[model samples]
Target chain A: MEPIKNDILDYLKDNSFMDTNIGLEDNDSLTQNGIMDSIGLLELMDYICEKYAIEVPEDMLTPENFDSLQGITNLIVKLVK
Target chain B: MSRIVCKKCVLDSDMPGIDINEESGLCHFCETYVPFSAQEKSDYLEKMEELFREYGGRGNYDVVFALSGGKDSSYTLHKLKNEYPFLKVLAVQFDNGFISDNAVENAKKMCELTGSDYFKLTMENEVLYETFRKAAESRDAFPRLAKYRASDICNTCISIIKQKLIEEAIVQDAPFIMFAFTPGQSPNPIIPLKANFIRWSRSIFEKQLQKIGVEDKDEKFLIKNEVIESMGKEGPRMLHPLCLWDYNEGQILESLVEIGWNPPDLNDSNSTNCTLNSFACQNHLEKYGIHPYAFDIAGIVRSGDMSREEGLEKLHQALSQPLIEEAAKKLNCR
Candidate 1:
């Protein structure tokens, strides 16, 4: 609850890979860094959809929107606004 | 030994942390049921249509088919080429040493018949086989399911396939990677856009080598994906058209056979694409007391695609005592 960005990143890292001891920066690229696999990516997407109640259009699931924590957080902010 | 499974579906108590409520005779996953009609679903179809429109004709190859020469992948190739003729499809296969003779032949026939571009990457799974044997020997956990879907072995194969597909797509500058996973076999809409999937795969392989008292210096083979942050960044998107469509397996099989596929053997294996699946399923069951593919079969039952009896039959086909032993013997782990 402290920072929505951190919350998102933390949840992602923790749930995925089970290798979450390492810290993730806000701008870190989760996909590029291999923090999660494809399954993990979908889980995060589903989580975002469920948590925010915003339906993510498949067209919008591009790397530009989901490649990094900052990019995803921005999308979340825009949607929940 | 008889297994206690969900009365509503196929999930068994063997899966990690799975519990069946005896009173209802349903597992928690089945009990917590909320089904949505097609109308309320997300804009998945509209987006898929848009993608098909945008990229189906835009590139030298718009999509890479993760073709295993099975009915599903073959059907996917057939549908894409015949229904959407403009899209150039690249059929990518990983020859994991044990691909069935029929599959190999049918794939060749498919290419000739369809005139589609084909590329096969061969990786001998000698080391992979060793890891599986070693895991079973050491009593280390073979990868099991958190949510029932692909059995551990199939999931491992899928991860490798996804990594290779993404790598090939990136290199070719292709816009999309296509795979044929029906409702039962798909991952949970999650994909690990492996930083360097080979690295991830190698780590697991290395563990197996260490078990066999062998060391393979195969690091030069690992591929790392480069993401140029400044460019208009787009990676390969997974397109599973089959998951969206309702298909009758028998009819699809008939269509595939007409197109040169051999009718499957009496086994009628769920994982007909890969020969290594039985070994993988055996590993999961031997170590975890659960069928690796139970979740997938159960999901199929839940979807009304297959009757509960049919799901059980598929599970029995792969996880039977004789079949499990046969797979392990082939891997030399038995």
Candidate 2:
């Protein structure tokens, strides 16, 4: 989870112009807190698919699955398993 | 830096990725933009049909159409109803106190003509106007960025529309929310990402909102959180239908006129709905010295609907004091 979270945090900062100074927490609600938006979700989905070599089942593109680093990590771990 | 306007279009140096080739007088965005091939367009239409088939009738309202009573949205509703009749659609229009009378009536008439359920969600104008005033008055960086994105008045109105559409999607169990934003309405596809930008904008707006007497609960509506926690990941997906299909304003207006939809009498030549559009547009122009609709107009030019000269004429509008005054009266921003 830490490695995945770290990679995602870096990706957000590098790719999306997310402010690294704010310091995203593992439990921070990215979308709910307005740190990300619809386009952000699309970018993240694309990144996760390429990074993990797993297509996020369309049904799993829900809020709970990608709400935070923690939730996204869980979804990725489950999909990889 | 001295601002360089695009030779072919209205885009200026302020626009991201805008590189004016000294020889050609065009920017890279315009030079590199290629309209979809016929085969690609056909494939996209087929995919849209597939989406409609899969999502149609899955809920009480299978889709929620964000209706602005503009030609694009009206045409989208028309085509969807005529072409994909099986889908249950709910048209939602947000009243931002500046929506033209004809637009409001047109929205109602379109719903009646198409036999679709319509919801007119009206916002508290006091708060709306105060926010608009702040948008007009505030020169702070984040607030200014908010203005630069959607104009001062439009940002507040659009925030309400966004909140309402998502809620309607959830409440009606609509699996998809359809927007009629054409490729023309999109940005450069590489505009600066608004990371923590909404939160910052919301905070600035909220300060004005509280001063204008809105409750805390209402403030939450302005926050865009659905991408995270609002619907628990099962929220309806926003679908831009026009991006999949070929459309030009002229064709859409002609089709709509045939079906009894008249363009609104408005100040903005490009706008056929909101009365305050020109006001916000002029404000942005005054502040940024760049047309807010540069991308939209450039998109239209790239898509071959209108000549770049025509687009420039529309963007570099001569001053219309009477119209601005009237729109200001409507918004009470003056």
Please compute the TM-score of chain B alone for each predicted structure, in the order given. Answer: 0.80, 0.82
lDDT of 1 by residue, B1-334 (tens): 3546898777777666567787987877678644434653345556766777876666568877788887888887887677677677788877765577777777767776777788887775676665445544543222222324444455445555665676677677677788887776664322323333333334443443343344546521233324222113445667776765666777788888886788644243765655666666666666556676676677668777778888787777644455456666767965
* DockQ winner: 1
Model 1's DockQ score: 0.12
- What is the C-alpha DockQ of each candidate? 0.12, 0.09
Q: What is the DockQ of candidate 2?
A: 0.09
Q: What is the TM-score of chain A in candidate 1?
A: 0.81
After superposition on all CA atoms, how large is the RMSD of candidate 2?
Answer: 6.3
Backbone clashes in model 2, listed as residue pairs: A62-B233, A63-B233
If you score just chain A, what TM-score does every candidate get?
Answer: 0.81, 0.89
